[model samples]
Target: MKRNNTFFRSVWFIAISGLGGFFLSLTGLSIGWMIGTFLAAALLSFLKPSLLRHDASKKGVPKYWLFIGQCILGIELGQKINLSFLHIFKEYWMTIILMLLLSIFFSLLSGFLLWKYSKTDMLTSFFGTAPGGLSAMPGIAEEVGANTAVVSIIQTMRVFLVILTIPIFVSLWASNPVNHVTLPAQTVSPFEFEKLLWTLVLIGIAYGGYLLGKYLKFPAPWLIGSMVAVAVVQSFGSLFMGHDMVSWWPHVVITLSQIFIAASIGSRFHKSMFIGLKQTLIVAFLSTIGLIFSMIMCAIFVSKVTGIALITAVLAFAPGGIAEMTTTSVVLNADSTFVIAVQVLRIIIVCVILPPFFRLLNYWEHKKHLSSHASA
Candidate 1:
């Protein structure tokens, strides 16, 4: 009976959150469904004890649902990979490398400000400002012995602000009106069996890659792995078949995935995370603003140097998650392929480079403390 009630409550929460998303979508906000559901779930979490019954059960959206969402996102991103994008990368390799370095520098600067002003520990502050995927950073924070709650909250807040602000800014700044591009319809194979077989093969590849990535201890393994796997398979298949592989991702599936992901992230908040709330929020907000401003300047420089569109450069440099930024690029009819590639490369670089540097910092701090203690 207890289990049944808990299940029902969880369902109710998801339903309410989805409704919030639906209403927000009506308002024409970028990523409205995700933003609305996240806000709604977060409000419920915050108000559980005061306005809501104390006995109301708190439950998160299932973890697998979040994983499923990641897989779908990975596949969608993978579909954007092609020979033409590779050509773009080769043409702009130097510019891309410069942009990546600038992004990392700005992130570190934000992390330092947070550490200096808010007294957040080094690891937590860095991870919170790292501009990696929201789902990935908190886990990395915990692995590095940081406060996961603080990291999660700061990361989420930063993403929310980026998503909320960038599109409006771009629309206003661009000389032409923002045009939304409708995705082309999927090209289905004439043979039904062949289509089913191709989809099954793609799923198999995603699963296999996910397992392999887990074994190898890759960062955000499932997402990165699935994306790489799908891209490889699609590329090979296209070479043999003489046409691009069509994505199975549909609008409804993507929206549902967004809802699930948003609800999960929202439910992570706890009242305990707010213990030093004002200071934390102020630092996070300011640091995020600083990061955004830095990226905008970098984008302008890149645009001028490389002759890429300013909007495309900005989207590529925006310190937001891959899914959110890519969606924005698609909606705003920017260079989504470039945005995804740059964002993915940035994530890989951060994950690979930050941990060792953090460990070195920890080692030095420990040594310094021990030397002082010995003198005392």
Candidate 2:
């Protein structure tokens, strides 16, 4: 019972942190709140690396909670997927490619600069400088004996700074950053207890699937399975039942859900683990230059090819992850969709590209060392 309570409390902390940051962003209070929160999360992580490190929770909540979040994202994304718009946007594909190449080029640059200046090995330094997940890269970094700590710190700090600065920058540059959309008040056509019961059953399915995923030691099992299952069902229902099957779901529920996400992300930051502040500050300066230079190149590339606008591409392709780019795009009034799509693509590329590159880098470096020793 005590352990269960602690889990609940921690999850609650995480959600609340997300909510607090979202509200602050909406109210225009702290453009930097998300970064502040992430920084706090890193601090929390350093202090208690196990704060939300529950393999169980990581395994469990997504089926029930995270699945719902993904559906919302999909719904938003699906709504935006216009065939006509895409046809027009098709010409921009080459531009997107150019933008992607620019990201890769700059990522290489950031890696090289870090390698030259720092004691970290080229391979670890290379992957460590990657932008997506601090967790994902550091693990890869350590396997080959790269400076995982430096990579972890640099990546986290890069995310931290992006989250803090991007929104403020976007809002400053955008034509009209705050354009809140109000949804129509929902009214259900009729009550069907049978369908309601089934929806509850589906939620239960998600719950159980998440738990089972934990047992299987799957990564984000809850999120992956629940999202896949619910999405499949939801998509099928829309195809057959004709859009009215899920009318009764509440906005209040969604808002609350988003808050939970924000808080959970925020609680990642605790007050400890900020020792040797000068070293952190120095690395932060270098990382900032790298991110800025990379973003500027991306923005210029988008401007030349897509002709969509410079600032939007820059905000979208900025090396920071989804949360920062999404929030900043919203706050800055840039094309959030464009920003998100590119960021998502960036993530996909990193997840796919980083591992192979790491392996190759190790092989090449090892061969180089052996050659040098033989010559000596």
Candidate 3:
């Protein structure tokens, strides 16, 4: 069982690793499935050079992996969205706006302080502070002519921090808010001819779109490509067989996906990356707590207005996006829609408010540097 460090070896390693995780999860060994895949990758990395250099011009590892990952993710998410769900928004829009308004102010204010105190630039501050998609912020930062590189690093760092620490903290803090259920295994065989064919087609389109995006220099090629594919397919009524209540298999896929994704993300947490993790812990804790607490208030207010329970309203009020927050809400049997509304609203506010704030911060930074240089 000698494993070489070549790229082909890595592909075999990943496939074997994914299969191991998938089967382990299929048997209801939830924790093992997660740990096994991660350990597989980690052990493989011991054989890998610290850096596997690839030419950006020749299409690197990140592109291919992300293309595959995003396609799988799209199939999962695309199965959820339907035009029929849009009818509940006739009056809820105002409350949604209010939720977003508060989330924006609180999130930005939190970021501003951390930025100033951490002595990081404004773009880094904004991305670091962003409360939504870890994969989405860097692209937006680049688009608005902000500090993309620094912001990307900051965003990645924050995501890593949250993914590692938040679950541990929640396990301890909430203790028994709800029993966390283990995800189920895939019942529809991955090897089934129909499924395999569809998956390949989806993967093909995803990768094709991804290459096009890279050539076009889209800031987040995978995101752009996957989202485009998803939107187009859904609009054209090419939806997959819906799994509304989340069966064991998709649950298995998602759980395993998170582990793969998380482990891949967590591998970045070497000692070198955590120069200030201890100091940043307070900021992270406070920022999350404040944002969550604010959402709770919004939830309470909305609940009083709508006659839902405080807990459901609060769950809905929390500003985390549809994916993370909604899933948690569903597991807890709380108000997932309310949560979705609040998150969507908040993202809209950030998209609108951030460009101007980012520009202001950049201008201020440039002026400060010029003044210092003049004095020198």
Which of the numbered candidates is closest to the native, going by highest lDDT?
A: 1
Query: Which tens-of-lDDT digit does each residue in 180-227 have in candidate 1?
Result: 645334243354656666767787888887887678775555666687
What local distance difference test score does each model get?
A: 0.72, 0.54, 0.51
Query: What would the per-residue lDDT of candidate 3 be over residues 1-376, giving only the tens digit for each residue?
Result: 3323435544554555565556655554324344455545444444442333232111112334533444454445443433332333444666666666676677787777766666455666666677645434544564555443344344444444433443343334453665656532234543555555555555566667667766876544564555455445543443243422221234545554444442343222233334554545466456656665665667667778877656555555554444545555565555666556555445434543565566777788889999999999
How should the candidates be ordered by lDDT, best one leading? 1, 2, 3
Query: TM-scores, in order shown?
Result: 0.78, 0.56, 0.62
- Model 2 earns a TM-score of 0.56
Cand. 2 Cα-lDDT: 0.54
Compose the digit string of candidate 2's lDDT tens values, residues 1-376.
Answer: 8667666756655554454446555644232344333344344544454545354222222223334543343332222223322433465667766777777777777776766665556775677667654424544454455554456567767765666665556555667555563322334335577666755755765666556655764334444334334544554555565442453344344444444333333333333323344544475458666666667766865577657766677777777766556656555556766776676556545644665676787798789999999999
Clashing pairs in model 1, backbone N/Cα/C closer than 3 A: none
Residue 53 accuracy (lDDT) in model 1: 23
For residue 350, what is the lDDT in candidate 2?
Answer: 68
Report, for all candidates in order, the number of backbone clashes.
0, 22, 4
Better by lDDT, candidate 2 or 1: 1
Considering lDDT, which of the candidate structures 2 and 3 is the better prediction for this target?
2
